[model samples]
Target chain A: MNPPEISAEILIVDDEEQIRRLLRGTLTAAGYRVREAGDGQSGLDEVAAKPPAAVILDLGLPDAPGLEVLQRLREWSEVPVMILSVRAQEQDKIALLDAGANDYLTKPFGGGELLARLRVLLRRPPGPVETGVVQFGTVTVDMSRRVVTKDGRDVLLTAREYALLRLLVAHRNRVITHRQILRELWGPKSEEQTHYVRVYMSRLREKLEDQPHQPRFLVTETGSGYRLDVG
Target chain B: MENTERLRHPGWGYLTALVAVSAATGIGYLIRPWSDYWAVAVIYLFAIVLLGLRLRQGPILFAATLCALTWDFLFFPPLYTFVVTRVEDWMMLGLFFVIALVTGRLTGRIRAQEQAERARAQRATALYELTRVLASAQSADEVLRNAAGQGAALFGARLAVLTAESEQPGRLVLHPSAALALTLVEQQTAWEFFSGRARSSRFAPPAAAGGRAYFTLAVAGRVLGVMVVQPAPGAGLSPAQQELLDAFSTQIALALEHERLRAEHEAARVQAASDRLHRTLLDSVSHELKTPLAVIAAATESLGATVAPADRPLVQEIHVAAERLRGVVVNLLDTTRLESGGLHAQLDWCDVSDLVNAALKIVGDAQLGRTIHLRLPAGLPLVRCDFDLIQQAVANLVHNACRHTPAGVEITVAAGTDEAAGRLWLAVADDGSGLREEQRARLFERFFRGDPGRAGGLGLGLSIARGFAEAHGGTLVAENQPGGGARFVLSLPLQHHEQVPAE
Candidate 1:
């Protein structure tokens, strides 16, 4: 089936006027209609009156309880909901998912990250479908033919290197938790082997970026997970 | 002849009696001529012996009178005649009779009075010693034992005191004695007495199985227990003994009450010490945790601004983790402050919606992409509260919901006024798995966690939140929603007048 176009109405719920204005401006710039709620209760009422395509929710409110707002919204609507919280515990993520949330984002996230997560939620693919050509900084990858060229010159990449690069490129501009990367590469039971992802990611950065120490494309989320900085 | 000398001694009582009888016989002979007075003299000797045994004073006086009469009748007249012809003889008889009567009466009265005074002195001394012993006894058990021993020694009966057990009902510990055997029913009675009930039993009398005693020890009109003493063989307690027992019982009651109060005071002192220590430890640990977390957060925030775009994610993670750690520290500090009377909320009249907005902003910036819903009315009245503190509490609830639930899950916050109850109700609900029965029981207790696996907290968020609510004359409660997830409700008294500053 063809994925829906990126035309959903996004509601920004935040107490800080600056943060709400920032979110409204960012979402509008990304070609989506935006509304704002200053607190949790107003955020819920806005969504209930006319269900939005998606909600960007803040976990703290003054007039009404934050968690209560989340729970009440889940009672009747399944409109994709994303949580905005400062806490980064694994249990928090798990609980939000169990409470009918679709995604989670920690604080201080940039506009790119916000947009990337939105795209993934709105356009979920049924299964892995390979696209033959890939492009980044002056580099083109042809997965079908197993060839790579930088600035139109043939560049050699080992078979292992290509596989690792393809995985990073596929989940570009979004965070891929260490567990997810490990499971995808070495099976579910070996997800705890984070060193393997680190070793391969280092090798990929050396081959692709001008500066491996501070690569523009590959980013580490430190204790939380890893993200691909594809801007 | 030696025996006759011994008999003539007037100081000896027997000799005095004999001399009086002989005199009476001589008088009778002398009076024989006057009248048949021999029988009267013999009767007088018999009366003297009987009176000496019964009316001790009366017998001697009677003997003296009879002697005088015999002299007048038999000796002062012609032989075998009842005639007193001489006036001198009459005066001599009268004088002799008066002397004899006066001597017998004075000696008998003096002896009787001396015996009575000695008995009174013995009783007084015993009473004084008992009072001294009771006053010095330190513990209830000591008082009981001493009382029993004194009762036994004074009354000549075996004594025992049964005291209430520390941890058992209808049970008592019999003080070290073999005087009385206690039955279950009697123990039950004693237990009732200790529990402020009056009970008495004749069936289980003192020092005898099934022989109840006369005196019951009581306090505040309630019997404490019984003081049991067996009656000495073939001897019941005298009036004096009974009075002594009653006095001992009163002392025992007073001593027991004093000991109980002292023990209670000691227990209270120990409890206060423990509470103070616990609070001190909490305060110190929280302070220690706060410093490091603040340092880390500051360091990370500065690093994020300077670091290259590629390294920003790592810096962000550090900042996030530090902030979370700071949240835990703040919770601990709040708890300690409440315990130590150090927390002071700055109260003000603030629009509830504005406070909600501030909390939502902080949570939103932190959450980034997560969804949360709110249902607040536009014209909600201003509430008197500590704005920053309430905001922090709300943030904690929202952050907790986000962490525990799955991504993109919705959380809701709602507020309304209950006019009938004259209160404001704010609720936070989540769609995640609800709290368990055990978790609900201890949800607000410090350092209690529902999920052990979850990391980065001291488990003080909910506890601190509840504490803040209570300080503002409100209550916070948690319950599981029927469909799924959990809901937390915070209710505060609606402000009718101008807000007052926090004291």
Candidate 2:
């Protein structure tokens, strides 16, 4: 994966001129090249003409909805996309994420939060990475060996808990919906049984986190889902 | 008056009968020398037949008797004496009498049948006119007006309509142009019919009291109203007229129901359009206000990087102020939604641990150096609720604790379930001073600020938290914990808990 020092090109597709300018200013200051599109059509055209390292697409656009643009882009490109949406649009955010967007930031987000989220998205590229080993907080999981160690000691985890941890580590720092987790961990028939995930998560937290209630890495997204915050 | 004319004066008919018999006698006397008594008898029968054409049964029969007597006295039997000389003459007299009686009876029956046919046609026309009038009426009010007017005309009576008030159910709306002033008892009777106690009533109030007939205006078992008709003094509705009135009421009820449905449909259409407009306006307003706030916060962050350390605090102030303004805008929108009855809970299954963590995330470490404890019990059953709404409520409580208490205070967030009561409870407790006696009573009032000097919100967080709780058929209450601090407990009903398979 390319680092920010490489000056990766970032495209911003938003209807508001001021928002685009702010985004451009923030990214350019953070050592990234920036491009702009005022509507969805131009955005799609720009992406087609020359794909950027990352795209920041606003949900609302004068020409077309951001979801359509994302779907159209996902048809051929695997470039990581970050969506900009309003606070009241949690459902739309989930839909965009499920539709191949890598991350989303609610509107009125501070520059620091935006950059932090973008950095994570960029660090974890679109295709699966060869993450043989991963570490967060005081815990380390060697994926290829199927072994998890906390503070230089082997920690006991049930088979389901180990699988859950693997899924979270696979997409570290990204929020996964309950539906997504259920489909992957159990069969799709158990999607409505969210308690399975909750019960298993509590056990994993007890085994790995110093204080299971105040988890450092494994985080809850309330109504949406769970996110493993490795930062 | 018209019905009286149809049954012409029997007195004048009797007088005409006498003149007809005398005319026959005069003609008989002139032809006596050249004619037999039978000839005189034939002339008498001719007069009786002519009188029968214009007279009813009683008058025509009188004419028959007179003509028969005149023939027997003047022409039959030993002239001018009441004696029967021959059996053939007596037989002739008897045959003539029988013929006269038969002619009178037949003519009377034909006239009566003609009158009955005319009456039927009149009723049919009246009913048809009423139907046309009611069908053309455009509104419920108009329908009632036309119905009453036509009904009054048809029955030769005054009519009053009492309808059920739609906006205020159970209240009655009496038609404005009602000519019949119903007495108290009559009104009660009308109400009884409207309420489905009676189908119809023939309320003939005694004496000079305004007697009336009441009919319930119903369609498909739903009573729309009641109709009261005050018949002309001393002229009550016959059974035939009552049946016609029944038909009249049925047509009126149908028209009223149609009009009501049309009005409801139009209102719903307008309301839907207005609701759509309201949602759009709110979204745009939020977007417009939030965009600039975002810019300000982001700009402040980037600006602080270049500013000297001494000036960084000023930039940070702007950032903090912008964030506060954003909160205010959100609160305003939320309150507006609540007041407008638009905040419907989109319920879903949720874990209490997730809810608590999300609230902490939203609070964002604003509680400088506070020691926050989590007491979420193991194996807490999942509860069904609107996840976002409950999260907001929990966040508001935590935020309220952070804002009201001094820095470094310990705030505990705990969750538990009351299985016996079928409820799930979440509490945010702070080791700050408990609420004052006066503040406890009005804490959840929309804009009631307990500590005016406190640098915090627009006094909306607690109120909004309560509203969200109620939306989930739950309750939020604030009381002093027994250990000398304030606690806000949000209890939500857990009715639909499912069986969790062992994992």
Candidate 3:
């Protein structure tokens, strides 16, 4: 999943000067080539002139709203974005994640936590790969054979259950909103039926995890969506 | 007064008729020497016709009779004789009397019609003036003043207006324009009508009930208030006048209702604008206060790794202080939101296990190597709640447990459901010394730090947890476990259960 070790660049788009300095210190200390943009227009210009490996975008910008910049950038770029935001703006976080943002960290976050989440965001491969088999904890899923085994024993799964598991596996380590789940599984008309995801998730946890109540691999983001942290 | 009472006294009409006939006799006598007897009769007829133009039926009839008698006695042939000598003279005298009666009757009818037309015009003018005045009034108070003035003049009465008080709608108070000097008994009667104990006396006969009548002013089934009018003694209203008063009451009611709606709308608009301003201010405060503390905390951590051994502890101290300040800021924001009625639970289907795990992770650093026991039973059904809020509440409980207990102590977290009550509960129990009596009394109070000497947090955790719990229609309670530690149990209701669609 690691890209070539030639030039791994990260672009930071934030209005606050001190925040930009702080982020630069953190990134450069971690041995990443860092680039900066003070406003949304400049940020877009910087990204278009020379694309970066990833972008750490802030939700608050002076020239235009961060959401608008994100929309404009997403039209032509597939660079992974990690949102930086304050805790008061919880209502908009879900929309950002659903709008192709890979992950997010609320303000006042610890330096170590930010780096850990950033590593996960950058570790993803740029293009889709066909993984014939995947494993987490004691459960093993073979995509080509359509078989799931736990501790060398066959585990029966319905056709719909297998489809649900494949969707999560495809977006593993990234947060996927309930709207995306419902639309992928039951068409767009079923967005209101969020209980469908809840029921299926519990069933999968019960079948695969050692303790279904405290799931390790399948994690819930609470108010946002779900994340499969296979790492 | 004379015109109104004219029909009551007919004797005065007869007296006037006698005087007029005597004058006519004198005129006829003077002309007798030069004219025929028929001409003398015609002069008397002329006098009766003039009286008819100015008098009613009774007076004109009297004048007609007087003319016939006077003409025969004073002007007929045979010099002041009562009898006529020839049949032709008798016939001529009879014809003159009949013609006088007919002419007088026709003229009297015309005079009565003219008087009726004038009365109608006066009523129309009075109503039009009242309507014009009421329409120009700007407020409810103005409406009351104008209505009272015009009503008293139009109906010849004293008027008082009573309206429901704006703040206390149950009771009614007199408006400033109440012109009627009401006695204690009359005021009590008005109150009775306002309370619906006594019905409105609309359409009652004029001057009924001691010369006072009450009319309720209402619009669209809502009673505005009552209007009481006391007419002058013995000057009661006619049915037509009563109808006009009804029209006035309707107009007054409409104006009052319009004013009330406008005031209410304006109040709502002002409140909405204030709420918006409050929200913007809070957002700015939260952003400004938390950003620098975040920088301090992160910067201090980075400085610690690279600093010399002697300076490492100093950097750590700064980090810890910044972290504590950050905690206070977060608590303050949560408290503000809770107090301002802005914390609404966005409920959705959530697994209790997930919430517990998320909470533990939030307070992970504070665990301090303590053993956490998870007793979440298998197959615990999902409950509906705001995932973020419930997780925060659980995290607060765990953090509270961690701070109160010594390092390496055990904390037990358990979960279960009561199917009969349809509730699922999660409890966090710490093996520290149980809470003291005084601490237990004010455990959930904001800023009530137990044992302030060992403080790390601003004691806002329990209150915020309770606030979040209540927001989800749930409850959080604290108690010392029987095994000698404090336990906080958060109980939440399972909102709904949907059948899983098979695929």
Candidate 4:
């Protein structure tokens, strides 16, 4: 049971040489093994021959649509995928994320942004409800005890706040839709209870964040939903 | 007048001529002392001329011969005798017969020629009227109705124009408003007419309506359609009338061709406009996208080897530019979809603070120097809306406020609900210099740059923002703030959702 576990490897499926080079250098320096495929067909073949721990697919592949490649890959494997897309296609990003890609990094992203997303995707445990301890900024959450600490001082949360925080921490760095949050905290029929999420989230951030107005850990994903940032 | 009426009947023509001559001879005898016997011969000649004018060739010839015989019998130079002994009297009798034959034939031919000319003139007038009506017709149905009416008047027939339908082969449809109907004979004629087996056909007796003639409508050997013509009651077509039917069928064929070409032209126009729209949409996006890509490339590429704590703003610059570019691109796509009528909102329960916060995330870093304040009541009810579209719209407003205002100005985004109005209000207020006095009207138009001095946008942000707002059954308006800067307010019909039952 104590035998050494091999570190995860990443596969980059993109047509742009600059994008691939940028990703490869950064990911290699971050201590993850990297592989590359230039077009969709070869990418699929590489994925088929030996599945990587994760895939970073560019939406505008030379051989086929990146979504098509993603759909095909989804048929064979459950490897986490992070999509690369130009900012021009917000609709496409939403569709790809909803289509089961783990996350997306819009084009013209810096090395820091790319690495942070990769860390979120690669480092998070596979199970959606894993419970232990997670730290973000100056705040620390103990999931088993259902407690949060800011600067080593205990922070108070109501029953609803604790539930929301626990759920967001379980899926930290990945966006959770408002509907999902409402449903999880308020039960199945509570998807329409968006204000509940908003109020509790603000209260939780106020207690946890150094400044409640400009949150450094709990972040809003604009049109998508919310994400917990571990900086 | 009685004699002329009699002359119209075959047997009665010559009988009437003989009777008139005999009556004149009797009168001549009664006035023997006063009237000359030669006067009786003159009366006989007048009777022959009347018959020639009224009767056809054969009857007029019979009348001419009968009158000459009656003159010899009743008042020859040997009065009341069949024989003429003198050469002078014999020559007189021979000369009278010759004059009668020539005069009769000449008068009959003149009448026939006059009737033919009158018929031809009427056909020309009908054709002129048909062309005039068809020229002003705007659509296929209008053309058919006018043609049917004009054709019925011109040809003395009830007419229907049947268009060959490609979808239902072997079946044709009459123009809906056409007042004409086809019998079995005309229908069969149309079937054969389409195959080029028949050109002009007449019905045996009509199965139902008064339809009689069927003429194939074609142009340059391409059979376009068919025309069913029913001769008017008591006015069955003559040979001349049939010729007119053929001519008018050609006119209908021309109109049908015009209708086909017009439909094709309409389809092509629609296709071309969409293509132009697509090109403009891409142009709006790409032209704006290039600058940000160049900035990002420049910023991120220099991140290596130029590493220093002071250079940290470089990463922030890339992040800001990337976000700014995303907003522009999103607006372009939305504008395209809106223009094409393809963008539809997927409405769901939404929160006002969520919209404000989301917009801040998008435009916050780019305009970091400016302060953005979000104000919302603690318990604003959920308004059903498409969250993404509303976010884009709000981002555009905030981004516009950022672009128009100089650094260090405060921008406020606030929301509230009006219960009585069943509406929700979201407004973005800026403290920078408000809208110019003259720029108010055209500000919401696409590609409208408020001031020439301001730079780096396609001017699509406001128009797209308004487009999103309107799509959710809402209205977006722009106005100058009382003190300074512009105020853009979006009002939506509120659909509030109830609180979820907790487990």
- What lDDT does the true structure give each of the candidates? 0.65, 0.81, 0.79, 0.73
After superposing the true interface residues, what Cα RMSD does each candidate give?
Answer: 23.6, 2.2, 2.1, 4.7
Q: Largest lDDT belongs to which candidate?
A: 2
- Per-candidate TM-scores read 0.45, 0.80, 0.80, 0.56
- The parts of candidate 4 lying over 4 Å away from their true place are A1-8, A29-31, A87-91, A124-166, A177-219, A223-225, A228-231, B1-342, B454-456, B483-485, B498-502
DockQ of model 3 vs. true complex: 0.55
Could you give the candidate ranking by lDDT, starting with the highest?
2, 3, 4, 1
C-alpha displacement of A53 in model 3, angstroms? Answer: 3.3
**For residues B1-503, what per-residue lDDT tens digits would candidate 1 score against the true structure?**
32243345454544455566675576655655666443554455454544354334444565566566555554444744657666765665565555555555665676567655654665676667667776788777777777767766765666667656467546666777436676778666555655545534312334545355545666677555556566666556655556656666666766777777788999989878977886567644653454355345545654566689999999988877776656555665667767876456656544454456556755765554567777776446557677667777777777667766777767888888987888887888888788889989998888887788976467777888888888888889999999998999888888664332112
Clashes of 2: 0
Q: Please give the distance, in angstroms, between residue B438's alpha carbon in candidate 2 and its true position after superposition.
A: 1.4
Lowest summed lDDT window (length 10), candidate 1 chain B: B201-210
Candidate 2's residue-wise lDDT over B160-239, tens digit each? 88889867675577888688777677777677767767653423232244457777788898878888877766576766
Which lDDT tens digits does candidate 4 get at residues B286-305?
53474356345534654644
TM-score, candidate 4, is 0.56
- Model 4 docking tier (incorrect/acceptable/medium/high): incorrect
Query: Per-prediction DockQ scores?
Result: 0.01, 0.48, 0.55, 0.13
lDDT string for model 1 (A147-183, tens) is 8787788876766667666776676554566567767
User: For candidate 4, what is the total of clashing residue pairs?
Assistant: 1
Candidate 2, superposed: residue stretches over 4 Å from native: A1-9, A29-32, A48-54, A63-81, A91-103, A115-231, B5-128, B131-139, B166-173, B199-210, B266-270, B302-312, B418-422, B497-503
Once model 4 is optimally superposed onto the true structure by TM-score, how far is the C-alpha of residue B26 displaced, in angstroms?
Answer: 43
Ranking by DockQ: 3, 2, 4, 1
Q: lDDT score, residue B76, model 2?
A: 68
